[model samples]
Target: MAGTSQARDGRMALSFILEKNGAPLTGTSGSLAIGEMGFIISKASSTSAFGDIPVGCFFIASASTTLKDGDSIQKVKPYFLGFATSKSLSQSKNVVDVTMDYDAATNNVSDGVVSSSGSISGSAITETLNMESGINILQSRFTSIISIDGSTIEYKEAQTTEKDILMLGWNFRDCKVGEFLDIDIVPALFSNLSKDASYGSSQTFNVDYTGNFSDENNFVGGHYIVKNVEGLLPSIARPQAAS
Candidate 1:
């Protein structure tokens, strides 16, 4: 594998590990971006989801467009993919490691946002992304007797800070049916992962778990109400969906 290939694939492959229908769908969030040009949907580069991004760097991932009502989704690689928001979108200078599966002909747009124009030069304002329904459990006990299925954990001696529970291959142990795991280790917020991303055409997009949960409002022993139910994007999944 090429040097850049591994890095790009590694970064993006994880981006698409969404729990689809309660199953981890190993896909990629190509990239979505909107700018002076127009709305664009991301095209996956490789099955490899590796991308060199900041710790909290994230862009939106969508199989389809949200803000643009009629914008038809372009299937670049069938996987959601995109670059980080580290810099502005430029056709010549800044485009890097971006993979393409769809072309101008294959790419389609429908029921888009609206026919409008902007007078401000270089002043691009991104639109807001919408999320499905979800809730947060505050106080709960996550006890897991993971069989490990008789497997070995990799990281045991690594330095794990107190803020983060340092257990290799057992993070899932802390999670249960009804508990919402915050991506960020701040304890009661979204994940450190990117909830929203910008891609192909400067179009705004988000990471959402469209998959359904195992049961509705089904409270388990480990899950407690962390905060009120708020409509956020997908990382906030009902893991019960996977069970």
Candidate 2:
């Protein structure tokens, strides 16, 4: 793995991939439209015909094509989150002080401390959007939907059901023409949404989301660098318009 010498910008493209019962969708092949978000089902082995191409990862289709099993493309439509004005991810762990009575007497010795391993605390991803797309995103997680007439929709105060979603992000500065890096947050839960508006400023919504480890998936989610040989990832162009 190589490192970039230049400082990268914070610009990123964000989207969501749906999951059922805490697992990725079954892989399939078809005419994947350009800029479609999808993931790899299986890697193209050396004995296969498309051995040079990479698989077993997520990608954004660069062009429309209808191919056989050799062409690794599993069309999994993602819920594209509108352009984000600002975004941030945070994670922390619980720490305990291990200092004892004997250690207090020693002036040269530093305080002992230990952190709980294999777990993360306060893990969250906060994003600010200036569009109304956040309303649909938040409503998808709600279990109870009370619709009044044809235009009004109300959600109950107590939401006992949880909808697990997968978040995918792509950084423009970190990706190349034939390769790109992905930031994934699997088994994520929507926390809250707050609207901010003023007399002269545009209205924006602050979306708070959290992710945790899933015993079934065995991992929370992290950054991944993938090879996009068949133009399976987007670079400069924006994703398809949100429906």
Candidate 3:
């Protein structure tokens, strides 16, 4: 058999493939194509086609690169670095819950509007949210990016309202950051909304959401949960000088 050789140089395109239930789900190939928003220059398997793997597991693969024979490769994993915190993902389980930076205060700064009754109406084809000022403010910022029909409606989590939702972009990610990580946002739904209304205080609601991905993009990372998070290691790097 002829000796197989690969030459690697310049910038290499990296992708993370997802395996579900010890099998490869169709359509999840490229990182951004599948909504997996992170990358790292590491090689875990010789075959680009990863074998059967389970959920909650991550792997690094190189799609396009020139690797010469006898090249020494380092073991690296693609990850996202948060602004002020770091969680050991090795301990993370499937269906991990992440708290995003968007809050009532942030919404207020951005001038979002929220309604008291909170109503979400319109067919699944076209939906709207007539929220109280706070949520309205937050949703307004993402409306351009998350709306399916470009209409506005709102609903209280406590109130039993009819909701016909297809995919909602409840979170916001920067284009620059998304380009750097090569990931995108899948359709999302805001669930479990709760708020604290005091006698003389601003009502702050907790916005919990769920994310979905098709076969194209399947991996989820920190970038999906935080803002302006990019560069696997440098995204979280801090000063090392004496304090």
Q: Go through the candidates in order and give each one's C-alpha lDDT.
A: 0.20, 0.46, 0.27
Q: How accurate is candidate 1 locally (lDDT)?
A: 0.20
Q: How well is each residue in 2-33 modelled by candidate 1, as lDDT tens digits?
A: 22222232221111111112211223323233
Question: How do the residues 1-243 of candidate 2 rate in per-residue lDDT, one tens digit apiece?
Answer: 223344445554455544322233332345455555544445434353223444544444455544445454444444545434555555555445566777855334333432211111121233323223333545445533344545644443434346444555645333565655556555555566556667776666555666655313232344555554544454323444432
For model 2, the local distance difference test gives: 0.46
Q: Locate the minimum summed-lDDT window of 10 residues in model 2.
A: 114-123
Instruction: Report the Cα lDDT for residue 8, model 2.
Output: 47
2 or 3, which is superior by lDDT?
2
Residue 207: error of model 3 in Å? 1.4
Give the best candidate by lDDT: 2
> What is the alpha-carbon RMSD of candidate 2 to the true structure?
8.8
Error (Å) of candidate 3 at residue 31 is 14
Model 2 alpha-carbon drift over 4 Å, by segment: 1-3, 17-75, 99-135, 142-160, 172-174, 215-220, 234-237, 240-243
The C-alpha local distance difference test score for the whole of candidate 3 amounts to 0.27
lDDT of 3 by residue, 1-243 (tens): 111133322122111111222223222232222222222223334432333322222333323233332222222222211111111111122332343576433222322322111122211111234311223322332333243334553333432221211111122122234322332222223444444567775544343333433222333232232222344322212223101
